[model samples]
Target chain A: MSDIEIKDNPDIKSELQTPPEPGYSEWRKDENTLYNDGLPEEEKDWFCDARPQKARKSVQVIENFLNWARSQSLWILAFGTGCGAIELRPLVTSRYDISRLGMQPRPTPRQANLIMIGGYVSIKTLKRIVRSYEQMQGPKFVVAVCSCAINGGMYWDSYNTVKRIDEYIPVDVYVTGCMPRPEAVLAGFNKLKELIKAGKAEGQNLYIERFDWYKENQKKVIKDWNMPDYNW
Target chain B: METLYKELKQYFDVDEFSVQKASLAFLRVPKSQLVSLLTHMKDIRGYTHLVMVTCVDYLEQDSFLLTYLLHNYSTHCDLGIQVSISRQNPVMDGIHHLWEQGRVYQRELFEMFGIDFPGSPDVHEPMILEGWQGPPPMRRDFDTKAYSEATYSHRPRDHKEPEEYMKQQLYPED
Candidate 1:
């Protein structure tokens, strides 16, 4: 009976328990293989397949000066992932004008140094967020706004919404509120500025360091990962 | 509404006709005659606007009740046509020809309720819940809470009753 059962099972448990196939980190060093297996053969050439590298730090005096300058003139990418975007709108308005702190909304990620991930991130929206976050230049900082981005807030039990924003991307500062007022966002920005000036906010480098972990977490939820491993 | 219902009854095998208000009424029709009745109402009775196409899962009854709400712009009257389809084999006639927007609704129904509308364009394609692998979420049999728990990892909750928390905050000394 034991022999019959062993023959019938066919090692199903071992098959199910096998580790997932090697991700980007394992084969990223290889020059010949494609970075984007999801994309069609024709379109693969359009995207850059190069792996991200850590940005080098300059001399102490220059680095401090650069950090100070970067902190003062925070060019924020105006990408709203959820409802917290409504609060962000008021920051640009006359009442809560964010320009007073040298922070302004930049239309594109290429020019922006700061990104505010506003509110709950659904699976579909997380894909876009990851893409945008990757597109941003080095020395970039992330300011996760609202309770939703911090820990899923009201969408805690939601099937599609991602709970912690940090699992996907490194967050420099967190502003906790259920749709935080513009005042709280400004405060969060102030905290981010402090971190930047103190030379503590290095989320961009942290992302590159733990790229594999982030990618695995992202791929777990985003089933249809049709884009490149790295968006660049 | 009574007059319209009586008139519709004469042409189609419509049953369970009830007027909820002066301007709104609901009636159930056989699945086969749904398209014809909708076309008749649109062309003849002036209920031209297709407001929405929604479904209610009757898990106990082993059926799905589909509602096709139509609005008449001129008279400001809303008419809902209901069709009960079997749960085991949920399929419905596509009314995209009568109303172009019906295709979008049909697509939504297909994704949510797993109801197939054979002729509707892009009905099989996912409208929302992209790349979803589990059973149709909107079906009554699909346990959403269980699915959520199984699929998503939750934070360890330190929950306190709102009333108790509030009272504790306000009267800590007590």
Candidate 2:
């Protein structure tokens, strides 16, 4: 007898072809009311609770040019989560000199376009990673380094460590190793550049589209989820 | 160290005097006499530094062996005071009053072993495993492998044994 059931039935489908409400969709939200319910009342004002919106891609020619530019100047947020962070240090030194690839370390997440998830992500660190990933502007990329990030590596059976990082946040590229060498990380950067130039690296947008699924997975592991639903 | 132990034995109920080296020794003290012994060593004897507080779970014995390793900076000697407490009770007298660093160690013991240090500050609060619902993980009975498998989802494993895989790669014809 419900509206959904009526629409599904072939006999009643012809009689009630049109929906009761004109252009009314369950997915649409009232912009003012849809605030992050997770935060305390006093702290709610500190953060923007508006859901993440997908970035509109520009016309093909201009978008391609912009993607090329974005790929060239990849500013990575300097956040080290685990032991794999050791591999990242060598990239800046004279031996590797990652600056030549147009990638440089940025102090804050807001200013950076890329976040390298260096090694295993414990539930505790995953909370911070989610917050930082959310804070970064759209078209942002994640380069998860180490076999630990790829699967779980040595911590596959660990009670504290996360098995797959992608369940919480969308990962664009995975550089595999126990702790991938600096050379392998550079190769990963090159792969990311190729993805960017081809307009394939849309992890930020994919995250927004599958926001609910990611949040559910994140909330399961992170028991003390006291922060706002979206840290924005 | 033997002279020091002999002198202390007359005053306090100390047993099992073990000499690890010329500079290191260990002795067992009853639970009730632990605080007094540590105080006597610190004030009367020259063992002024409290090196560390550690616990070992004896599952078969149903007891937890708590060790308070103390050091004498002047003599360059280490004395470890061992006290065995019941697994059922799992309570210890807080030595936070004697050494401030003992408070942190007590807090860690409380978190890892479910041991209670009633008077110690923030002893009940979680140290590392925040909002952990299960029993104390460091307990011998707590099956970590089972807990991990139940809690976290795993990828379908396509892994082969290293020796066999290496042989296949090196000698494909065979």
Candidate 3:
């Protein structure tokens, strides 16, 4: 019995009709506005934040299901920039069998949502890493694959290596130790999966939002900057 | 090995020559005869295999010893030809012509020690370190740790977050 119904009208017109409260005028961009208390500058997170985030709420059932599906099936990128990448070999092989957890290494960044930064990033390699990170599709995540990613590990005093990976790019998770064992790698993935299920791992969106800050930090170390504005 | 020593004595003007116990020969030649000696070793002595071209900075002597190591596959003997150049101007003859691989080694030496190889074109190009403005790192006076600290930004030194965390962790009672 789909009967026609009339919905109540919003009271925005009535608010517009009311006069300003005793010299409270502060250059009203929207004259019919209901809320006047602006959010504090400190409350806004775009300034000096580690990563960018957007409030994309999954309201519909289909959107919720899609988010669930994305969490369940993550295509990991096979890009390893350091020596720690050797550890990833055993994880994919018969012994570890990471494929059982619905994670497999994808060759192309465009198809993959997960990137494992498998080692120390030199200034030379940082450029390529930035390009590769940017090339990855949205709803992507980053797992810093070693202690080298944390603080350059053994190459701590070396002039060429970058001490921290987070300064240049946002990392969703960090696998500690010089080279974390296959079990540790799996645990790191499990943690990432938990975050992803909760829709907390939004590094890909964060990168896009705070790209200028990331680019500036990148240019400080990389002197010969000749790539395009956006790598994508 | 004995014949190689004999040839070194006959062909080149040398400061000292000796045969080491471990199937090797050592010849310390003057700075002037470096190129000629290397040419002779390559052309006549059949020590065509260029093992390496390295330098050692002797700060006390105020000179840098440029050593050219050559090996003969047939005889299985190593010969180190040494030439000491002034500390002020450590320049050497580019023997990349005799052994083509010497270009890379000399280029690396040039990058690390500022020992100029005049004829090698790659000496001016960027070798191991790109955009290196500081003094040659391998020199005695060029401090590696100081230069490394000054040139690049490290984590704990630049950001004290980890240090503070460690301090809190180590002294939790405090």
Candidate 3 deviant stretches above 4 angstroms: A1-64, B15-21, B157-174
Candidate 3 local lDDT, B1-174, one digit each (tens): 666667677777874777776778788998888888888878877888889888898999999988888998878889999888998987888887777888999889888888888989768887656556678877888776565556455554333456557979899888
Candidates 1 and 2 compared by lDDT, better number: 2
- Give the CA lDDT, 0 to 100, for residue B2 in model 2: 98
Tens digits of per-residue lDDT for model 3 on A1-232? 2352222223322322342243223322232321212324453332222223343656767666776788778899856888878998998899999888888889988899898999988877887888788778778889998898887788776767787788688899999987798799899999998888777887876665555456556777776654543554
- By lDDT, the candidates rank as 2, 1, 3
Lowest summed lDDT window (length 10), candidate 1 chain B: B152-161
lDDT of 2 by residue, A40-133 (tens): 8898788766777778999999999999999999999856888889999999999999999888999899999999899888888898999999
Which of 1 and 2 is ahead in DockQ?
Answer: 1
Ranking by TM-score: 1, 2, 3
lDDT of 1 by residue, B41-148 (tens): 999888999999999999999999999999999999999999999999998889999999999999999888999999899888866677788888888778776777
Query: All candidates' lDDT scores?
Result: 0.84, 0.85, 0.74
Better of 2 and 3 by TM-score: 2
User: Which stretch of 10 consecutive residues in model 2 chain B shows the poorest summed lDDT?
Assistant: B153-162
Most accurate candidate by lDDT = 2
- Go through the candidates in order and give each one's DockQ: 0.29, 0.25, 0.12
User: What's the true lDDT of residue B93 in model 1?
Assistant: 87
Query: What are the per-residue Cα lDDT tens digits for candidate 1 across A61-165?
Result: 999999999999999986688899999999999999999888899999889998889889888888888999999998999999989888779887676788778
- Candidate 2 vs candidate 3: which has greater DockQ? 2
